[model samples]
Target: MEKKIADALSEIDGAGRVTVVLTMKAGSRRMLAEETNNDDTSAVLVSRGSGYQETVTVQELSPQYQGALVVCEGAGDPAVKLKLVEAVSALTGLGSNKISICKGK
Candidate 1:
């Protein structure tokens, strides 16, 4: 995702050599369910009637982005920085406050 954002930002007229770093609020977690097995394998394995088991990932869950740091040569200029901010915001669905632009080498 960061790579895609950086590629898009590089399309801006003054933007050059864009690098994007994303900060996430938390790592993705999975839901679990309880299951039991009465088969012979249970004799060797830990046999818990209501054993905890990992379930398929919840499709609705999405990673929450805390912020983004963008570095680009064009970010030194006010106009280019604003444009970069807008581009990042659009791609991340985050507000301007969550995006920071910095001058790059």
Candidate 2:
């Protein structure tokens, strides 16, 4: 999954696009709070049963490129969010460029 994500990201190199992946716990308060503001970003929330099982939010951080698409892979684990961020950051050499996980319900 990481390789697939990385491959998709690699195509946008030097094209002025930034991609990020995020995972959130099911029915997390933090996740609910963040989902209040959703606009112009790509996000997905998946449920395994009755509640919000997990979520993956991807955001493209380049105004110059309007056609950019953010891809999110659901892992059902919040702990992997940091690792995904770090991996993407390292792979793209994008440091602190105002990227955020979109709010979702």
Candidate 3:
């Protein structure tokens, strides 16, 4: 996710060598649910499959973004820094105060 944010921010005209450090209030965890199987009869059947089968799932969670530090070239300029702050705020649903921008090393 940090890499994606850095890639997005690096597209700005004045942004270069972008570095983004993300801080989260809590880490995301998986949700669990109970499942039951009632079949008790014993029966054996074997079948050959030609291809692999896999199940993939994507789950959405609430925001955990607490803050972030962004360092990039030309970020020393007040205008550029402000722009970066706003951009980060919009992307992360965080207030400007939570996002900090500084000039790249």
Candidate 4:
């Protein structure tokens, strides 16, 4: 996540040498679609060929981010800082209050 954020932020105009730190509220977990019948609860299975049963994967849930810190050479500028904060928030699903933007040496 940090790497992704850095790469993304580096793309912004004047956001040079971006660095990112992220805090995760919870680790990612998978959600599976299940089959419930009366007293039985089981994973929904799909048959391949000749009776090969495969568990169905609904979707992969990404980790929830609590906060983010971004340091960039251009962050001293208000516009650059705001852009960094917004980009980080958009990528991490966090609010602006949870993101910090700082100037890098």
TM-score of each: 0.67, 0.28, 0.68, 0.82
**What lDDT tens digits, residue by residue, belong to model 2 across residues 1-105?**
335654654354231232434332222223221344556443456787977466654443321211112334422234444444455555444442433322222
Q: Report the lDDT tens digits of candidate 1 across residue range 28-80.
A: 56543334566433212344468854333334445678999999998888999
Give candidate 4's TM-score: 0.82
Clashing pairs in 4: none
lDDT of 3 by residue, 38-72 (tens): 85533333344666533332454665899999999
lDDT of each: 0.80, 0.39, 0.79, 0.91
User: Using TM-score as the measure, which candidate wins?
Assistant: 4
lDDT of 4 by residue, 1-105 (tens): 799889999999999999999998998987788999999999998889998988888998899999998988999899988889888888889999999898899
lDDT of 3 at 76: 80
Comparing candidate 1 with candidate 2, which one achieves the higher lDDT? 1
Which of 2 and 3 is the better model by lDDT? 3
List pairs with backbone clashes in candidate 2: 35-103, 35-104
After TM-score superposition, the amount by which residue 26's alpha carbon in candidate 2 deviates from its true location, in angstroms, is: 38
> Could you tell me which residue pairs clash in candidate 1?
none
Candidate numbers sorted by TM-score from highest down: 4, 3, 1, 2
lDDT of 2: 0.39
Report the candidate with higher lDDT, 2 versus 4: 4
